[model samples]
Target chain A: MLKLPSVPGGAPPRPGTPAAEPASLKDNASEAAISALGWLDERTAISGTARWVMFRKVPKGTNWFYTLGTSTMMAFLSQVVTGVFLAMYYDPSPNNAYESMRHINNDVFLGQFVHGMHRWGATTMVVLIFLHMGRTFFFGAYKYPRELNWVIGVILVLLTMIMALTGYLLPWDQRSYWATAVGVNVFASAPIAGPYLGDFLRAGPEFGATTLSRFYAIHMLLLPGLIGGLIAAHLYLVIKHGTTAPPWIEAEIDEDLRKSEA
Target chain B: MPDTSKNTSPYTADRNIPGAFEGETVTRRRFMTGAAHATNGIAVGMIALPAIGFALGPNFKKLEERWEAVGRPDEFSPTEYISRTITVVAGAGETGKTTVYLRERNPDIDHEPEDEYNQYIAISTRCMHLGCPVRYVPASQRFICPCHGGVYDFLGEVQGGPPVRPLDRFYTRVKDGLVELGPRFSVNSELKRFSPRDPAQDLDALGQYLFPSRPTIRKIPGT
Candidate 1:
């Protein structure tokens, strides 16, 4: 990263803007500030174009309702950071899986907590994404042009679930074993290709070390990469769709009726 | 579909646009479409997730379990069976002290159950895949590994799973009234019958008799 020059006193770099004699420099700074603010302003307002859809300012205005998308993004970023840490200690093998995990708990500092957080946070992403989608749906946000974005969001959720499932097997212990067996059983219940699917997935007779390594790759790399792409697309769509009108529209209608009484 | 296009009234359908006439409904349509697709996309994405996970891994950790020894009897249990596991201390090998299970439960046969006049066939719990301990699963009637899903029966035969072959079984004999297991031996079977460490099929009769599983492709007689 190229570090920008800053005042020694610790401030944003304000080199040429003078206190009194400045004219063009002041104009330049003001122009820079105004343009920054203008970009923010342009992304708001109820009516926006496909060319540039203003999202924050809608008929309803930014309220508690607008936080869901940002919240989902926050959780995803947290996963990336914590997942990176967990990758440091997680061993992807079936035999020494439980022993390695125990070693992490007993030997490595803060390893247990990081592992727990990654485990629990993935679960929370499932919940939060559902809630976010629900919030978007009942509001009739996906009726027309937003359909593709809705699909992308769904893909994101599925990717997250895949990531979580793959992570589940990396521990390589008995719990990982049986859970995977149940998973394979579910797969075996699928249409015609069940048995072949199970064998192919396991890469052998049963879910063992080979299966663990495969899942670890998918969890730590494959699904996560897909998720990253989908999230980026999802955000792009969010910027395009803009916010929906709030429930307060009905409240406003009610307030107007009461105002006549007053 | 109820003639969706005709549902719009003529007044709404015809737009008098000279030059600057936007569809007006286009943004609304786009927004709604985007949301709809996102919702649908997520549903499909979520659906693929379980499928992807199962394909990637159907881990057996849950099916596996931990094995804990309740305790050994003062005397070897009658072994109408061929296999029995006895714990040997790291240092006790030199003393030739091994616990053996009697093949038949006979109270009147010879002294008490504690005497050193019995034989027990015992297999180690270690998994062949990673050397992790295997557990005795009576319900499944196989010695299952909690670490991996390796399965073994009473005869210490590795039935299936990732294990290369049957687990190592230590032959036990009571010598001088002290239950003593063998110096560690694995026996391969080509001929039928409960045979001891046969010199013919022994991979390492002197090293540590390790056995190999014979595939059914070439059916050798006896075993």
Candidate 2:
């Protein structure tokens, strides 16, 4: 039997403390399950890692604002789910792109709803991320050891914008066409290397099959892959450094440190 | 004795603190380490520059508009409006087919007309609300957007339902007997002229306040 330390201030156990009872069937089953987990944990160290990351103590005074990051993460996951569903029916060719969108919008079961969710979810993610960033800035959580995480976050913001821009062109509507045209033209205005760079992006000299293909590839594969890797890095950093305390809490800590030294 | 050494409490004084891993010592090794990090950063940035430039190249090129011939003026009937699809090759090498709504007006009823060339008015089929293709309903004499309930009159004026302004029109000209269509220009709300105005701009000040304008092509960059 394992022994536990006595409580600091507690009444002494009665003189006739009851002897330990034998394990019942239910208790045996639970013990067996715990031992199985222990066997796995011995090899994988899963329990220790989970305790270290998941159960780490965060500073007090965190409010609902902290939830924005999780909300953004959920929104991004929804985008990935809906985006995959969309890719199953969406044809990347300019010729069939609009027609496929029409078919999805009007024909497929719950297609319009899913598309709407993805669209609204993208906007929600953008807004939530911005709010999250604002909260971080206001709390000065991006200072000191968290600076690299902030830089990663800025990269994420840029990637999200690029994802939105690339996704906008998939509909092949007049708005998308003209908007993409103008968007690409803006890149062409870059000084000496502008024309060459613009041509490469368009996949030639203009927005055609190549442009659609490139944008589709970037939207569906490249940007998502990059964002996923960056998100992993961001989360790792967050866990590694731990969350920054609110300004008041930090100030209190500072005061305590100065007082103790004095 | 209690196994205090096994306890990994976060409240312990020697717990890891962020940015405090490096000892408080200024040495040649630290300077060299910082310089190495800076060099690695510059190397990574140099590699990233060409990749980003290549990926974003399309945004740098200017696209010129091209005109496409739809049909001869005589081919379209004066009695009823007809919609024709014309494939226009625009900027770089992008080709798209746009629906052009053509109707010949009676010269007798024209006290002041917008199209003086051949009494032919070519309106775009794209809805002003969200760019869904609006279908022409002859019985109701209105262009009805199926996506939403947006309705436009025969003159392309917004009669009801979510449309902010009239449908966009194509710059049409009659050369010889063929009707040549230019790039699309949205209609002005107050003047009813073909201009590069966004329908969002036509919203009342209060409406604008209620409905914020999204990033659109109408807002020119840098100004």
Candidate 3:
């Protein structure tokens, strides 16, 4: 008969042996935690999903480079958290946007830190995404069945860039205004539909009353939803296909198979 | 259940489905599925179409033309360009206000055929390169963009750098002794008038056809 391990710590004593008393508060706490987890798991069966996502079989030669995607995701999560809090104080109106940003930086408690995290986290996320993409390319991880994942990743990259561009104008300062103007003009540089696209971005022929608010909606609402959704798809594919082995690590033929062939 | 697999007929009645009307091509099950799908599509569209239209509504909206008086006709000089601040967009406070360079039309330099709107040349400070505000340097008699080094001559023609065309100009009309700057209009390399276009949209030849005028704002016809 197979003996299953006990949940808390050690295996139960033999049937004839004397039962031991549970010792220490730590053991009781761990036992309580385990039972709670089991209780939840019994109803939801969520542990299987957690196990499936977290305990994936990574390919051989997995190294520090493999962490870049997770690092990028972490950076994005940091941006999301910081951005949510920042939105509480941000005023999208052109009349108050600069003043509100000042209030956030100078008046609100920990506002500067949260705002700084979001601002810097954006750059960190961009850099990390590029590094992750470079890793996938250099390792040739984008081949075969993983091509769809690569396409999804490219879309994510575009979404991230849009997030950056739209988010830039939230500050409502001279630089933000000018940079966005230049950026929209770049969009207008495209032939045929470019002019209409520019109008769509500006919400008019010129940057008007709603331009700042438009950018705010895109930055905080539209883009985050899209980026987050695409990221979920990207990660689902990543887990489904597992990961590619480092290109430097070549396959080794079995000695028996080689001998038979010889 | 009837053994109808071998029938493979086009009509439900031919297939021997129970309660099927004669000559009915569509099965009740297929019709129900299509109805449910259509109902779902309509429901989704009811929510989605309005939201999409709400977002894109601004593209087709035409803004009202605004004219702001900058100075009296005598205040402007034909030989020298003077800067005047005017509101390009309302309700945006100082952000909407832009600097326009105003001067009386000098026939020696201004070759474009004279009209009621062009008697006083009102040059838009918006750089033709990338929409950066260009400053008129009195010493050099040139409009210079600080951001990208785009230079335009006194006539607002692209003199150097990456400017695709001349700096945009506004309609000038002397209303009640005051020179009023009206809606902006873009000019091609030959200084011919066209609807206002965003900076970097070249107005030369095929450029106009490639980058069509937006529906939101248009130049006054027969001006």
- Best candidate, DockQ: 3
Question: What does candidate 3's lDDT look like per residue over A5-108, in tens digits?
Answer: 34555435436533565445775566667667776776789999999999988767999999999999999999999999998999888899999999999999
Error of 3 at B65 (Å): 0.4
lDDT by residue for model 2 over B36-55, one digit each (tens)? Answer: 99999999999999888766
Q: Which ten residues in a row have the lowest lDDT in candidate 2 chain B?
A: B214-223
Cα error, residue A155 of model 1, in Å, equals 1.8
lDDT by residue for model 3 (B100-152), tens: 99999999988989989999999999898889989999999999999989999
The lDDT per prediction is 0.55, 0.71, 0.90
Model 2 misplacement above 4 A: A1-32, A253-262, B1-223
lDDT of 1 by residue, B68-133 (tens): 232344544553433344433222121112232223334553232332222344555545444445
RMSD (Å) of each candidate, 1 decimal: 17.3, 14.5, 3.7
DockQ of each: 0.03, 0.06, 0.82
True C-alpha contacts between chains kept, each model in order: 0.01, 0.09, 0.76
Model 3 residue runs over 4 Å out of place are A1-24, A254-262, B8-10
lDDT of 2 by residue, A143-249 (tens): 99899999999999999988888888888887888677656645544444544545666665435776898999999999999999999999989889988777776
State each model's TM-score restricted to chain B.
Answer: 0.37, 0.62, 0.97
Better of 1 and 2 by TM-score: 2
Candidate 3, chain A: TM-score against the reference: 0.88
